[model samples]
Target: MKNKKKIILIVIAVMMGIFLISGMLKGKSTVEGLVGDPKGTFVNVGKAVTTDIQTKISATGTVKAEESEIVFAEANTKVETFLVEVGDPVKKGDVLLTYDVETKEGLQRDLEKLDLQMETARIALSQLQAGSKQSIMQVQTEIASIDKNLLDVEDGIRQLETSLVIAQKDLEQVEKTYDVTKTLFDEGLAAEKELDDAEKAVMKTKDQVSSLETQVASSKKNIETITMQKSNAQYNLDLLQNKVQDETKAQNIAMKQNEIASLVLQKESVLEQLDKVEEKVLAPIDGVVSRVGAKEGSFVAPGAELMTIINPEKLVVEAEISPYYAAQLETGLTVKVKYNGSTTVETEGTISMVSPVAVQKAAQDKGAVSTAIPVKVAIDNSQGLKEGLTVDLKVVTSEVKGVVAVPLLATMTDKEDNNYLFVVEAGNTLSKRMVKQGAADNHLVQVSDIEDGDIVVTNPTEALEAGMSVSYMLLEEVGE
Candidate 1:
């Protein structure tokens, strides 16, 4: 029992010495310096510095011409010949192609048909005018003859009236003579034969007066008939005059004139079309032809695209950006463009437009489709840019200068949802700093309540606590 107790004491002493040596080594290792500390949690660190921080959105883009146009066919016709090919440089008004001969001939026939119709309308109008004049002259002649007959009937009635007046006086004289002869016969101083003769004379005068009155009445009737005929003829002349000036004949003339005018307009339109089909198609602008849609014998409909032209001097870069940056993307933002080719070309640009709506993009990973907004950047100098070339674009969304910033990794969130960072304090201790984050990029974040040159733990661990003693190496010294 005594020997077992002595062996137990020896083991206890050995164990105590081992524990003391381990503790001393661990204490020695925790000393702060350029070398790392083993007792403290191993972490990466960065310095809070005053520097400019820019937030950028990266995207791939395609170079495109800002001025591009597609020339189209103006009429339904077949292309007879192509005067220009793809990649051909052309000036405004230069001939690009020609139409088929059949089209020109068809237009010429249309023009000739219009001309013939117009000539026929003009001749019909002249014949209508001549007929109207002849009808008017006939009616005027009839009215003049009726007027002369009326005047002769009136003069005969006047002559008959004068003769009737003389016969009335003669009848009065004969009545007086017959009364005298009867008075003499009653006194038996005149003969009976003489009295009979006086009575017969009175009766003869009465008959003459009645006959003259009848003639005058007949003449008056004839005058009335002639006057009615003259009135009818005058009415016909007025009607004929109205017809020639403002009624059917005038309306017919107007209709013929309108027909002629309509034919004239049609002819002009057809002539213009004929001129176009006869001449070759001209370029509307100065550009390089990028595409030709028709061959020499191909038929094209009206408004069909014939070729595409692009002005290379005007260039822009088009890119698709995520909706996450929609609020930041807008016109007038600066952009950096890089074209990776046999020789990389670098240039500066500005955001010219941002689409208000979003478009669905194909699923790149065979997953759900994503949405992106299109943006255009106008290059300041397009010296080395070409149409349809793919390029890289860096859009500067936000920027700040002389601000206190730290690595994004240095920030942490507490249970209260406040942002805080582990800043290295004096004596190599950690102090939990509550900061107000202003702007953040992918790598750095702008923070308030953090001083410049404050060493901050960029890669903090879960076990890290505030006020804990730490042995740290400067991030710069560690080349991180």
Candidate 2:
């Protein structure tokens, strides 16, 4: 029992010693924590730096293809076939799709009508050119013939008048003989039969004279008819001559040529229309079809969506900038583009344009407004860029030399739009100093009224206040 009691006493002492040692260790840790960070906070420090500062206009933007184009149906038609799919690469002049016209019957009817018109014009022109001259030539030949017949009729009339004169003189001589015979027979100086024969001779002469007169009258009538026919022929010849004059090359030939030319032109025009109606839509540029809006057999209205093509290698940023700085932006100014969610991946570009007008972002809220002007930035090297990606924009407007600069982390903002910083005094106590910030690129800004070599706390924590005790640090000492 004595040995067991001694063992219990030893165990109790050892347990008390272990508890005391643990308590002491815990107390030392509490004291160390107080010495290390009295306010349980971390202080980030940076010095007021004197350096060159560049001012930049900041904006947010989205990636756009340099040559993005939206294809639209140019006419009302049904899609015959879609030759490309979404994401398909296409070259310029490649057929994107074709149209199947619903008005095929109407088009065919129109073509037939045009064909008939052309045929009629062609036949009419040919007849005027060939048949008209032939008719005039025939009329000229007939006129010549009529003129020759008229001369013949005049000669026949002269011959008939000579015959009539000779016959009349013979009749007169015969009548004198008959009278002489009658007188002689009555005085019994001649036979009766002789007298009768003389009388018969006189009658024969009278008949001959009458028949010659009838022939002369008939010749006169024939001459008159021939003269009238000759006059009619001459009038017809004149008509033909006038027709020839009027139907010369300047008239008939030119008219025919013009008519044919007009028909040909009309035919060509209608053919072109038909070609357009049945033609395939070709790609106007080399790109990938990012979206296919119409499918095969779909009916579309004029100017409706067909597809969207975008070149992945050619990209630009359409940034919206504050209207205050928009006037300072111009083409050819350098730009820095950063991917919206990326910190390291970035590229340099140039300002392509600045919009002249400001656009409201939202409806006004009792005079408070948000508006911006569009600014375009062109990226020289656009590899790995995608359409519609968000981007951060910075346009370096001007550079300033010998300005007091510091990290943006050191700045604090108040509700009044004023900025300030916490500067450590000689005894390591912090005092607030009002600062005017000029230009900021990213993490650094040009600060006014802060002298070089002044220690400014970069990040002020909740543990800090005016005239508070703090541990000191130089950021360079920590490899930060």
Candidate 3:
């Protein structure tokens, strides 16, 4: 029993020793496994490469024809037949439509009426001119006759005055003789018959003087009447002279001439239309008809819309951009365009125009209004483009070639506002390097102080520090 008990204790002690050895071995194995594993943070890394990069502006645009024309009716007419329909290709000077036969007949009638009106106006103007000249001549003749009558009346007045003077002298001598006879009769030295005869002679001389005076007064009255007649005739002549040079007559002649001119213009216009009636409406440009506004057997007024044509070969893309880019947008900038949601239909283009002003537009999502500037891009190759097709555009504002560049995620900023990049060094250790950033695009940034073939950490966390070790996978190896 003592030997057995001793053997049991020995076995127990041996089991305990085995357990202690196994525990020590297990602990040592765990420590060795941990020591064999990667010792730091895991990260993805990319290489700094030399490449070409561009700063691009993105925009949505619509394809449109560069050249378009709207046709309008030149005169009032009815459509006889439409020679072409919408979407029909037409060449320059091709007949587009025809006018009704009655339209030409109406124009001819209008021309004839205009001719008649013009002829009537010309005749009236001629008559007015001839009458004006004849009236002036008649007034001149009347004035000459009045002047002659005035001269004749003046001569008569002078002659009557001379005769009256002679008769008065005779009367004075007879009165003196009568007085002498009266004295002789009173003294009884002369006969009474002689005194009576002297008195009678004196009375007869007085009557003759009175008659001469009356004749002179009558002649003076005749002179006054003749002078008044001359004045009236001269006034009439002056009126006729003024009328010949008057604005009223000139204005009447001008009115007649203007009326004739207007009638002539109307006649010419009608004749022109009549001449073109057979030729009909012609296309003004080589293009495809896009819209038709008039129908057959429909009457249209002058200046009404007829149709619209667009030249599809000359295609352009129109877009609106934010006004914030107005200063940077310019003509002749290179552009890449795509249409119809296509990826392979991209074509090169150039900016043809940029609006100098901003226009207000409603926002696509919020319905708020904002200002935008209009822009147009001329397609270099329009093989896959069509009118009114929506397109995507990327305008290259700036570009750099053969420069050291890296993924934008590889860069970081510090509390001092300094820029830096964590470059993967030998043995998977980090080396923080200061860099000056230049231009940047959506995914890559142009950087200085970084060499080509350098391995940079694409995503550096805040815990990452300089001289810290890390386990990394190459972006290319990871297929990212």
Which portions of model 2 show Cα errors greater than 4 Å? 1-46, 50-58, 101-105, 110-275, 340-345, 361-370, 398-403, 407-438, 441-444, 447-452, 456-480
Q: Over the stretch 197-281, how does candidate 1's per-residue lDDT look in tens digits?
A: 9999999999999999988888888877888888776655665566335575577678889989999998988877666564477
Worst window of 10 by summed lDDT in candidate 2: 32-41
Q: Local distance difference test, per candidate?
A: 0.82, 0.75, 0.80
- Candidate 1 lands at a TM-score of 0.58
C-alpha lDDT of residue 211 in model 2 = 86
Worst 10 residues of 1 by lDDT: 1-10
Best by lDDT: 1
Each model's TM-score, in the order given? 0.58, 0.46, 0.58
Q: Model 1 clash pairs? A: none
lDDT of 3 by residue, 137-254 (tens): 6757877887787787678778877877887898889899988888988999789899989989989988888887888788778778878887776654554566345666667668
Model 2 has an lDDT value of 0.75
lDDT-sorted candidate list, best first: 1, 3, 2
Model 1 residue 409 CA deviation (Å) reads 0.4
Candidate 3: global Cα-lDDT? 0.80
Going through the candidates in the order shown, the clash numbers are: 0, 0, 0
* Candidate 3: Cα lDDT at 397: 85
